[model samples]
Target: MSIWGKFAGAVVGAYFGGPLGAVAGTVAGHYAFDRELDKEVAFTIALIALSAKMAKADGIVSPVEVDAFYRICRVPEGEQRNVARVYKLAQEDIAGFEAYARQVAEIFADRPKVCEDVLDALFYIAYADGTLNHAEEVFLRRVAENFALSEADFSRIHARHNPNVFDPFAVLGIDPNASFDAARSAWLKASRENHPDQLQARGVPVEILHLANDRMAIINSAWEMIRKEQFNKDV
Candidate 1:
């Protein structure tokens, strides 16, 4: 079945309250949505739904951001309407975007890497136009703050999306004055956390999982640069 087919009229959630529940309540019936798939659906809904609110946060949605959304979390053809349903619902929700963001943060509280992925998605969208507007940057900064992502982690993700101005140490969340050992340790830890298989195991959307490959490469490149410049070594 198509990705959308799994959730069509299948109910986004049960009796849970708030915008999350409201979006889940759209099913309009006591349909027993697959419990396993429910988790995945929640992941997708949270991503797209929050992105809808984010478009509003910045007061305008760039075509590049929209395109980045499609690329980063691909929805197969013929399922656009299903995705649109949740997006529209979120944009019109009475609840604030932070409320939804908090709910999502709670849902993935045990999985910080997943939360990191969420932040990564937001940065990807915000920077899609090659420049993250002031409002958009502030909004995303609030997201990272809410997610409890450290400044280093947040900047690392930011650096990933802007290649022209990417700071290698920033990508690894370290200072150039740091020891090589510290840099190496940080790189290894981040590498393991960002492996595609690890992300898939954590229930990330497959497309997002694929992004780990690129992230993994970026991390390695950062380490390589740091090594060559700071340690006189090749990774």
Candidate 2:
């Protein structure tokens, strides 16, 4: 079953206790099940919580941002209220985003790429309003730090979403002076890593696979652009 179906079911369980669990419990209400939360379930909850906190980074949650989230998360019609409840509760909760980010970092400690995916999702929401504001950038940078992502990692992800900048090399996390073979190798490695199947294996909810799909498109585009440029330069 999809993550939404899991949430819609009468019994909901979140193994980890803390801000994320609190928000999930509140959303699930009295329908408590005694079992460890599935990784995918936990992942969805984390995404909602983090997205909510990011929305408040700029002090307001624009409808466009919310719409972008819905599109990325693909919350079903029947489960929108429940999903929205989690988002709202997380936003209203007094816990700072760092706490939630820390929890997510710990939850996916072994899977750094999944953490990168989370940051990528946040960038998608941040840019939905047509710009990435100062507050939002600060919030994202701090979250990236909390996630244990390096500066280079953050820059590569940011390049994909930053409208005003389009450095294909940055998107592929490659040095401009790198050999064509090295660039092609980087493209292949990235494509393998960001594939939807790999993401699903890493506990990303299937609903969120579209994010992976979109990211793959960007990665591929960057490679194609680089390939064409190199060919023209050689000619």
Candidate 3:
């Protein structure tokens, strides 16, 4: 079934907690059973499904957020309404977002990189209005937990969107006071994981995969900062 067909059917299950459910009701007569959705399809749907909830979590959905969201989703102009319909449906769905998060997590369970990509997409939207508010941060952290993302992992990703301070250690997902060798190892691992080509190879869709460019840039900037700090300290 197409992504919308699946969502149209998915309104029945609280376990799905996704599109079609009412702000206080369930998706009307639909498939009682869950269809096996393609990972790619699921990926797209989840983006639409959870986005409204994320925006609402912050208490205000700005025009800028909406614009950033469309750009991140990269839905073709022709298909914009279809994606918007799902986003509206999801916003109206009252089921806990945990169900939606779980569904997405299940599809990418064995594919952690894909899960991270999902988080990256979510982060992009959260920052769309120019700041990550308290509600949005709480909402995203829970989503990350549902995706089995570690606190350190979530922190590193969050640091990219919210760089209030130039803390290289947080960007590298390492302890600030770590030994030089430990920091170097952390940077190498970050380099390997966030390399644009490597992320694309991991099955991240092209639209979302380009986010790796930003990730790589952040890692590179963090590493360079740390490198200079270390070199000057040694000299």
Candidate 4:
């Protein structure tokens, strides 16, 4: 309630000849206002929690990720003044992230188009400020994957918002092959695409480039896995 609204309610209650009446009226007004604020808080907190989890996906959280969230969410300074509240909310949100995800899934159930909108919003958050860290990208894809969103839907959402960065096969620019050179080339390409410095130049701050490194490692590992399979088949 607005200040004036609360004051008016309190005044009316006070006229009824009991101080407790005014107190109760004020409390009621506050409660009503708080409910709406709570919803907004919950929504924002949920997004932050999702973002944090995404940041942790590549195995480390960075100040850059945190900064990206603040910038993308446009969380105001005064609201963020309550750092403890924000932190606590973030924890609570993370604890309930899956629940919220499920709830959203249910809410948009039978409404594929609406679900796409939700996914789009999520991708916007996930890629806000020009880059999605590996963890963030993986987390986003997982979210879509969990929903079993159609490949078409997934592709549309991804293409609309995410980077076309570091496609492992594309990086290597070669088909899976029997030659070691092919695997090595793929790794080299992926590593170059995900080079830590390149990430920084692309607006992924130094702190968050660790995710790029982690992704590079994944590309290497995948190459190794494919190489082993090819070698085994040849044997």
TM agreement with the true structure for every prediction = 0.88, 0.93, 0.81, 0.43
Q: State the lDDT at 132 in candidate 3.
A: 82
TM-score of 1: 0.88
Cα distance off (Å), candidate 1, residue 222: 0.6
Clashes within 3 Å, all models in order:
2, 0, 0, 1
lDDT of 2 at 155: 97
Q: In candidate 4, what are the lDDT values of residues 1-235, reduced to their tens digit?
A: 3222333343233212122122222333332222222222223333444565565666666666567566555544544543224333444343434444554454335443334434554675566557777766667766676566766557544654535543434324455453777676656765675576754443333322344554556566556655666554331
- Model 4 weakest lDDT span, ten residues long: 14-23
Q: Across residues 111-205, which tens digit of lDDT does each residue of candidate 1 receive?
A: 87787888888877777777777888888888788778888777788888884786888888888899989999989988988898888787686
Compute the lDDT of residue 145 as modeled in candidate 1. 82
- Per-model C-alpha lDDT, please? 0.75, 0.86, 0.70, 0.47
Measured with C-alpha atoms, the lDDT of residue 118 in candidate 2 is 92
Better of 3 and 4 by TM-score: 3
Supply candidate 1's per-residue lDDT for 235.
47
Off by over 4 Å in 3: 1-36, 233-235
Candidate 2 vs candidate 4: the TM-score winner is 2
| 1-235 per-residue lDDT for model 2 (tens digits) | 8788876552254435767877888765653543466778778888899999998887888889889999998887988888888899999999999999998898888787889989999999999978999999999999999999999999999999988888999999999988988999999999999999999999898888988888899999889888889644331
Q: Give one digit per residue, the lDDT tens place, for model 3 in 4-69.
A: 443433433322333422321233443343444445555766777777778778667677777778
Query: Among these predicted structures, which one has the highest TM-score?
Result: 2
- The lDDT of model 2 is 0.86
Which residue pairs collide, candidate 4?
Answer: 172-186
Q: What is the lDDT of residue 171 in candidate 2?
A: 94
Give the Å shift of residue 29 in candidate 1: 6.8
